[model samples]
Target chain A: MLTAQVLYGLTACVIVALGLRGALLHASLLQRVVAINVMGAGVFMLLIAVAYRGPGLPPDPLPHALVLTGIVVAVSATALALALARRLHAEQDND
Target chain B: MNTTNLLVFDGLLLFSIVGLAWASLATTDERRSVILFMAFGLVLAVAWGRLLAPDVALAEAAIGAGLSGALLLAAVRKQSPGSSHTHANPDRNYSESGAKVVLQWLVTLLCAALAGTLAWALLHALSSAPHDTLPRAISDNLVASGVSNPVTAVLLNFRAYDTLLELAVLLTAVLGIFSLGQTTPGYQPAGPVFDGLVRWLVPVLILTAGYLLWVGAHAPGGAFQAGATLAAAGVVLRLTGRSRIGLPDGFVLRIIMAAGVGVFLLVGLTLLLLGRPFLGYPPAWAGALILLIETAAMLSIAATLLLAFVGGQPQSTAVNAAANRQREENSRC
Candidate 1:
């Protein structure tokens, strides 16, 4: 019988697998974004697992802060990328 | 580990990733793919929360998933329908040779093996470590910072210097965007109805942002999170045409821009005067000082980010109209 942690680990593995597949197989820009996001989610899940220390240990707060910062930075980067993409599309349309 | 719960969570995460991969692989339409990508971001946010990193989860949801999704969707809307359908095939010039296929497989295998090995090592190290120093330090210092959340202590006290630098990075990003000169060009001016909406929403957003900032002293909320929310509201207003993009170089703008850095610098100087180390918070006043600095920092950051998103010169009316129109369309859809 697999424990919850083990099952969660499996989940993280599967998510990573899917993210790699998506990144490798997909060519569409939006799809690439989706693949990256999926990968990010997997990494977050892994971080969560690391933070989980038995039943009594206080949860890790550093990871939480780091992840929060990561999320904000990720969004800002993505927004910038999307803006660039829009401009690229516009330029292509004109061309 | 409970086998059933583990299995269920594993299944959910696997299914989500696979679904995202399938969507990415199957979709030829760039627009749809972008939407799917945003969905993937949201799911990832949920996963982060489940992992016991609530702060990360909140940030991911608001900034990563929410803001990015909005930006992407806006970009998509701006694109001409026909341009979105064009697909650039990478393998177009490549001959379908056996050697190429073999090379690809070999590369993939190598990458996977390396990743697997790295993960295994990390897992082993995490499980076998005799003592975790980082968590202990944070817990010990949590009360001194007058914050219940150890994460807050780490961010604001133990590593306040890092937080200060991060704010600087944010300011630089805004400057970079200004140099781009694309400031809110696509956004239209707002109408009378839009003004009414802004009047109702802006105060509420400001109030929420204030509460979030104050609670961050002992809770999950903080300056970055609150600033982002405030910026979101500003972005909304800019999009709707209620708020124009000014030079952000104006006197007020300059002050707001410097406020975070200024407060940080002043606080460090004040501590130095008291014979404490630079960036060290004094025992009696750590909470009060941190809150004061953070409040200023939040305001500065919020304004800076919003200005960055809008591009350059603040054009209030046109941008607001466009934002309002877009919001109405989004709500309807």
Candidate 2:
């Protein structure tokens, strides 16, 4: 049987690759945000995949929790960053 | 072969992600880019759910996609119209020199190789022996922790020290943002339609936030989730000019900010006084104590983040009056 881990691992690789490309190639701030987010997703996927090794053993719930917390923190940080960016844009427009 | 099914699923995921990457890379408009990024976050959240990390999925959807998108959009709106001039246009010089292109490819190759090696090493390591001491310890103490969710148990009990530090980091960030110049830039007041909507929506949001906070002890909800919801409400109110900047450095604000840290330190100190190592949970009060701390932490976090977003202390009465007046004006109009 093709295990879920193998599928997730491959997916993670693809995500990371895309994220790196977005980060590097995209000159716009919006594109950079998307790239960083993609990277975060890739990392999260890897964590979940790692948690799914054994059948009898319960999955590693700690990483799930940590990643969950990390997501919220990331969003909050993103929001604040976006606010700053927006203000900068407004100021530039005025100038 | 079951492996074939797995491969197909993996392929689908890979295809979607690759497409998104390509689209994002090709997009020159920063505004559209942020929106696409939000869409990408939502897709990633789905992938997480499929990977059996529902908790992560919830978090990703709410914070990653929802909040982050809002932040990005807000930033885009605030930017100068001229800033759009910086975007790469097809007509412009888009090609790098041969050396730069070669270096870029080399970097991409190196990153891919390193990532592949790391994944392979991890899989190999995990397959062998399979003795995970940390997971074992958590599972063993799950019942004692009085939380069925192993993740919650670990966060609130086993490794609470980390959680405490994380709260500190959040508080620090909020404070840092506060130190930045005036956050509440005076804007033209909202129209009657917007004012009417805020009047109806604020209470509903607060109620939902409370429900989420209470559900967090057992399910996918938690203080962070609740706090974010509450902060959303605060942000809405602030934006509508229903809340004005008040003294951010007021005594009450300081206490609320300190409440989480103070409770944590007190609890740790109490453990030390009882001759146990710091943060060792007392069997009798562990669950209650953790919940109490979490509640305090949630309030402080919500308030801090909201204030940080507001970029100043809100003048509570003025904003409330403005909202009230707007509501009246809406009815009259």
Candidate 3:
């Protein structure tokens, strides 16, 4: 169980870094949006890892609930960002 | 599972997750990248399941992987409006200049440092004996929280204020999308085969959404999962060229979008009036109250997600129906 936790936690950290690199380096707005989501997923994964107790024992419900809320928030944020991007594209077409 | 076996599975899952994320970001093409990201979400969902978070896994599958993929794909289609097969990505060769390459290296180093710091801190935290206080507290109060499921109890009872605020955030997002502009012209009507599929798929999705909502009080399902499932039905309907997507426009749509937050606030205030703390339900009434809140929340979540997928406020169905009739008459002429 400890091994699983550490592995996932470390993996989450790496994913977050990769996402940050993409968000900073990518030129396009859409790619940046995708990068941000990847970062959010990493954070969620980390929370879930922290919440894990053992193979049979029920994990911490607090972090589970927190990650659930985060997922919804992340999707909404993605939607809003994509809307802004689309509006920008429409405006650019006019220009 | 034994330690070694579990370790191998964890390693493989983690490897695939990181690979998928990297591949998704590395691709320059928007459609390819979004598709890869969706695949990443699915794999991450599996990881969540492996970590023993069935609720989170279900949500990741529905909202994270499914609906978000649909939204991103729709945005990609809009980005390259003229053709289904888009040309090479405009952002494809970004590392040409010397200055850009130097910046890229610097940024990469910074991210690596961030990852190293996080991992170091995580290892230190894990090395210490685990804290059992909070989890113990949750289990103690689990019965009082009114739901048998600890996660549901936390979301709906113990930490309900957070859930309420989360609903507000969702509402804020949909409102932002609506303010941007009208929705894109919808898809063409589905062909016969797809139409038949929709007939079967939509009903099953709706049934599942209802089942998830009811099962949430005890199991791994809840308002968010149920709401996303319901929204999937709407998305399918929208994709099949149904402009209305079963949504009543104007006042009704606004109400549905606001329902989650509105119901939550109303319940909180009512409980306060009854001399309980905000969102603190009496133990005896807690289960019923949570169910009430979850139902309203389910409706609001479904509306918000469907609208977010649609990308903007839709025009009323009346105008849309009249336009369709006019077009039909013109074709006859």
Which candidate achieves the best TM-score against the true structure?
3
DockQ leaderboard ranking: 3, 2, 1
- List the candidates ranked by TM-score, beginning with the highest: 3, 2, 1
Docking class for model 3 is medium
- Which one wins by lDDT: 1 or 2? 2
Q: For candidate 1 chain B, which ten residues in a row score worst on lDDT?
A: B86-95
TM-scores computed on chain B for all candidates = 0.79, 0.79, 0.93
lDDT of 2 by residue, B227-258 (tens): 66777777777668753422254688888877
Q: What does the lDDT read for residue B109 in candidate 1? A: 78
Regions more than 4 Å wrong, model 1: A1-38, A54-57, A79-95, B1-10, B21-26, B78-111, B188-200, B239-249, B313-333
Model 3, span B196-269: residue lDDT tens: 99989999999999999999999999999999999999999989998668777689888988989999999999
DockQ of each: 0.43, 0.48, 0.78
How high a TM-score does candidate 2 get? 0.80
lDDT of each: 0.67, 0.68, 0.91
User: Which has the higher DockQ value, candidate number 2 or candidate number 3?
Assistant: 3
TM-score, cand. 1 vs. native? 0.79
Over B1-333, each residue of candidate 1 has an lDDT whose tens digit, in order, gives: 675675577568657855864575456565677676767667766665555666666666666766666666565555544365645465731225788677657646764664576467546746575356888888776777767778778887888887787777666666655554355455568787886887788788788889889988777788877887888787777667544432254677878987988899899998899899998887779888889988998888787667656645453577667767876775676
